[model samples]
Target: MARNKNRTEVKNYKKKKLTVSTSEESPAKKKKMSPKDPEDPDDALSKVESPEMKDLEDLTPEEQRKRERKLKKERKKEEKRLKRESAIDDDDEEEKPSKPSVCELSLQYLKSWSEKRKDWKFQKTRQIWLLQNMYDQEKISDDYFPILLEYLEGLKGSARDTTVKQAEDLMKEYDKSEAKAEADVQKMSRIREVLQLLS
Candidate 1:
């Protein structure tokens, strides 16, 4: 009887531990990883490894071609799913999306303009600018504007006017040891060099 009681106590203890640990996981995570279907090695391997890759493999060859054709349509949806998941993970810290002031938005839009890069040209820049203006006129709130600004700060512009403006801005604030001064000047010159290639 004592041995049986001890065995029962150990079993209960193990169950308690498992429950405690599992409680931290999500319901989606609770779903068992489905075994790789042997008939589809790619699918099986992907499932055991990367679900994203597996999902891609699950499609028939013909369906895959169709899938590629519609990638543009699906890109936004995939991005939204990732964004939602990221937002969920960031629940510990509440994030407040800041609307860019008109001046800030204009500055950002101008900064994104490229005049001569292989992929980015004046035409595309103008299109984006027009789109931005239309969005503003339509009173469409851009929650991603600030995020866009972060990327814009890193993009290389391809126009002389924009390059010169960027350099002048750098020259103006070159002296004040605010933050990342040397890096700022270097980045500005790099942008200028890229723009110079257009000429």
Candidate 2:
């Protein structure tokens, strides 16, 4: 059997493996080393300030520290103001919804109908909304109350009955309270005015 020369491993007697010991430092290694003082006043690294505060370098050390502190406080205050403004904007967006309420839609429809009654078709939902919200001054303003009452002239079925029922009830309340309090007298008279107009 022939021995393959490629399979045989050759060891060089001249070559040697080098191992570094932790105790020795290599001459090839060069590094800058310095001692850190915890209380050194002239320490550049310890006295480093923000880029914006670099302009204050010409001031006295005490003045520089004070200016830096003042600048930091002003920066934080401005940030807080911006945050508050953004929060208020978000709140406003949340409070004021994009879509109008049923009352608004009802009022819009009523106004359109009032302007062009022949062109504008009647909507049951708007009629019902007007009937429901007519009593509340907050929901239906005094300016539009008369118009809503006029619109109610064409109301029929249970809706018309309900309005009469509510109007009679309001009248009773008004007459009873007339001697005691005259606060809602104007409110009751609004319904009465409509009844008079209808009659």
Candidate 3:
């Protein structure tokens, strides 16, 4: 391990003896931390060998049982903390109000025209939606159907006539079907209502 090759010549000479005073402890012995020294938690741990730090095989049966109980308690405490966190998250989600989409907002806006007619201005897209879905029982709820009828009082010439013609044709087509479904019967009733309103 010597860095210089020529340094091997000194190996033949006898090694110098190191003298130790009888008052001092042996160099190989471990030193105890003094009370006056700066306190270090790890230094304290190093001085005192803890029984809990020993291997499982070195532990007594009672000590092993105590350790097992401590581990079980820690696991149960962690599970309880996780359960509390998830419960808080679920409560937060329940408290939050869901925002309505653009389509639903538009429909609600049109419905509000009954109360605020001064706010009513012609929207071609909304008029088109009324013409397309006015007669469908599924698309138009019964509560909103009459409201939409009042709204259509504003519709002039062709759109009004088209709505009437469409209702008549759908009603005739539905009447011809011998084995009508419950949903079709519902639609036929709504078409009759539409024809009565617009015709």
Candidate 4:
């Protein structure tokens, strides 16, 4: 049997590994390393006024308010974006045309129907009122309420009083709801009482 040269093992002449012990650094290696001072005013200031420092004193009053407003708006937009993204078509639920609440749907129906029955100027006026109503949701101004009330009063001869009364009552209810909401908020807050007194 021939011994294969490729399979032959070489003699290992390597020294066995040893764990050498180390002592304190030599004078050459121990070049002067300074210790930090306990009471440097500049260092103290630098620590306090670092890039990540929460120094409201450095920021302008307007800048502070603007940052807060921006943060609030971003939070609101994120909430709205999440709500819109999560909208699901629930098939099991009744498919009766889903609307933006009864109040909003009624306002839209009235606006469109009134536009068709009446004219452009009236539609424009109604649209402005509708926009304000959507924003406020709680308050109906005296200007709009009286205009609507008068219109309803005049329509008594043409349309049923019951129908006109319902529209009039909706406006009245909106005003009453706003008043109640204000009262409720006042009752809930001691801060509001202080602010009211200051004003």
Candidate 5:
């Protein structure tokens, strides 16, 4: 009877050990099976309280000034970064060929003449001279040329005759250049045909 009771007690003790071991192992296994928490710095920062925050509401004047200076420095850095980015954007825009506004075109034309004639007395004459140069160089697009010409023609003064004469002279020169280009093209075609015949 003593031997049988001892056997029974040993079996109960084994069962209890198994149950305790399983309970501990099960929690560990569950921990391994569960998904890991995300590693976001912002989340961690949000959860953590800064030491400065506790004293923020009751800051001494010196501490307050230091904090203000730090904030101002960060703001200035941000502003500088933004300014640099904006300047880069502006440079990109400048690289793209944008059509000149009428005012800009007119100013460019006037500037061209002003550079040539320092003592150019009359503003009206200067404008007319600029128009003549613009037409000659083909700086203004063909579509906008007539519009500019009309604007110049509407201006009444002693410079009107000089301006009209200059326009006529430029047109004649333009026609001659066009004729010369056509002749060159014809000559090239003739040479190409002769070469083809030889081949």
Candidate 6:
């Protein structure tokens, strides 16, 4: 008899606990599942229909024409705004001068002169111009001066007297500079060798 009473008490306790847990959960679930209010008419209309298309069939001819004109004006304004933005972007890009490639610089130099010269003359002139420009801009190191001179020497042709003279002058200048540099280097090395011997 005592065991039966204890079993009944345990079962009652479990039932009471379940009811308390369910009660606690009900309010939270109710908050989450609450009914939403009806959507605003303006929001619904904006989403599903544009002002231009709304009630078009019911409107008179004059009203329709006015709507059409308003749409056209808005379209023109949008187009103008886009064009203005594009112009500003182009101006920004132009303000920043990009580094020119050798071929591009050559073309620019050729375009600058009005008189037309022979092909070989033009090519030699272009090469000299490129070397000078690159040297001035510090784009080409002094070590490459000999290589550029050799390249110019290789372009020599009997086609134009003036071009050949110019190339020879440039070559002579480069050779003199290179010789001076070599002599300086040798003098420095000899001084270093003597210092080592003394040490």
Q: How do the candidates rank by TM-score, highest first?
A: 3, 2, 6, 5, 4, 1
Lowest lDDT sum, 10 consecutive residues, model 1, at 132-141
Where in model 4 is the C-alpha error above 4 Å? 1-97, 118-147, 157-199
Tens digit per residue, CA lDDT, model 4, 1-199: 2345322311110110011111232322111111136397655565455331233234456644544464346456655866766654344454767767644554554544545555423444554444335223244333333333333333324233434344454445554674556644432242232223222
Q: lDDT of each structure?
A: 0.48, 0.61, 0.62, 0.39, 0.49, 0.48
List model 1 lDDT by residue over 71-169, tens digit each.
434445555888999988887488678797665554444445432245443445543453333213133224433333343445455533464465455
TM-score of 1: 0.19
Model 1: residue 30 alpha-carbon error in angstroms: 34
Query: What lDDT tens digits, residue by residue, belong to model 5 across residues 1-199?
Result: 9999767755654554354342334333323322245486544453234333333334556654654465456456656988999999999878777797655656555544335546433455436445454433244444444454444545566555655555455445554775556544543343333223322
Instruction: Spell out the clash pairs found in candidate 1.
Output: none
Cα deviation in Å at residue 76, candidate 4? 49
- Which lDDT tens digits does candidate 3 get at residues 1-199? 5656335423321121012121243322123312224387765664455322333234456654654465456556656988999999999878667697544654775776777778866677777876787666666677887788777767788888888788888888887889888888888887876777667
How much does candidate 5 score in TM-score? 0.28
lDDT of 2 by residue, 1-199 (tens): 2355322311111111012121142222101011236466544443453222243454557655655565456456656988999999999878665798888899899899789888898788888788776767778888898788778777778877777877777778777763643436556667686566444
Score candidate 6 by TM-score against the native: 0.32
User: Alpha-carbon error at 12 in model 2, in Å?
Assistant: 43
Question: Which residue pairs does candidate 5 place in steric collision?
Answer: none
- Misplaced by over 4 Å in model 6 are 1-40, 43-63, 79-125, 131-140, 158-160, 163-199
Error of 1 at 194 (Å): 5.6
- Alpha-carbon deviation at 77 in model 5, angstroms: 3.1
Residue 104's lDDT within candidate 5 is: 63
Candidate 2: which stretches are off by over 4 Å?
A: 1-97, 178-183
